[model samples]
Target: MITKDVRNWLGALTFLISLCLSGCQSGNAPASSPIETNRSLAPQRVDIRGSILSSQYSDGQVILEVERLSPSPDSRYDRAYVLVLPTAQMVDSEGLSVSISELRPGQNVAILLRAGGQGNRTGIGVARKLWIEDRF
Candidate 1:
């Protein structure tokens, strides 16, 4: 027969296992593929000084240039990377290549990030946000 402590430990182990298994779903899709969907997304545009774009942000974030801008059925915009100023950094430790649809060229891709969805001023979308400006 198992003690009460053993039962609690088993429960915690089960919970952690379940969480780990759920995370594996993202592994099926490679990082470079375009996200094709019809999900509704409203993207807000912002223009920042190109000279200051890289200096203001913390590490793990970068000011990438928009290489291409495509319209997806899901998000209002699909940006691809043409060039990245400073260096190309990974998001959330996922060293996966930043996709072509995730940026565009000639324009500063990201300088100020928005939390969650790119609107909040105080929140930094450091782990999961891409900043981009389309207008010159």
Candidate 2:
């Protein structure tokens, strides 16, 4: 049998424990990991060739949605990026840092776009060479 004061103290203690546990869980919130996907070949062996329909920057990389317009009788879309490898983070050539604006639209370029996740987006990217892979 606990007194009223003792009961209140227990309740407070319980509440504090719960709050601590919740804080730990919330703190460990997972970040966006590009490597955690079925497609592991991303950023390692990505050799894509496509025509840039449009390019934009997101999260740090160049989000380029291109059109594989030639090889096929009908064109298909392939999304890619230009990012830093190994770290799976977006960075520019020269191993520095870059943005989507660098890869301007209306520009024909072929990049090593890492095979993305379920969204068909690439992981990291490398602007190996631009305006070189002329399928014309």
Candidate 3:
């Protein structure tokens, strides 16, 4: 007859095996392609300096037409990026916190972007932080 300790150990081992098997099985979920998995895991960060073409305060969105100053390899030339800004931290030229309504057309701004979804190639980006520049 098995001892109480042996019985308990066997039960724990069986439970662990079942847990491993369940984790290994994907069930009804479809497998994601390697590219899609990589994209979801890591988002690229992009920094850009441009002038605001227009802004919609109600929507918390800004349209920035890049001036191509110190362009990155991923930067698209002469593109207007429609950036979502509701969660972004905005600071003025004086480094004071500013609201979306304070932003106006023709104001030079430097923005740090978290490029996802269609990526930076499509000029679609989420603004992580924005600085209203006095000059570009």
Candidate maximizing TM-score: 3
The 10-residue segment with the lowest total lDDT in model 2: 38-47
Cα TM-score per model: 0.22, 0.33, 0.49
Task: Report the C-alpha lDDT of model 1 over 33-85, residue by residue, as the tens digit.
Answer: 33223111213432222212222233533434232234323232233212233
Query: Relative to the unseen true structure, what is the C-alpha lDDT of residue 50 in candidate 2, on a scale of 0 to 100?
Result: 55
Model 3 lDDT tens row, 40-109 = 2111333556667766654546555545445556344334465656667888755578877787888776
Name the lDDT value of residue 129 in candidate 1: 39
Q: What is the C-alpha lDDT profile of model 2 across 9-126, one tens digit per residue?
A: 9999999999999999978977855534522222332344456667666665555655553453221225554443223333432334443455665554445433432234333445
Q: Candidate 3, which segments miss by more than 4 Å at Cα? A: 1-46, 59-77, 116-122
Q: How accurate is candidate 3 locally (lDDT)?
A: 0.61
- Per-model C-alpha lDDT, please? 0.36, 0.47, 0.61
- Evaluate residue 49 in candidate 1 and report its C-alpha lDDT on the 0 to 100 scale: 20
At residue 11, what lDDT does model 3 achieve?
A: 96
Clashes of each: 14, 2, 0
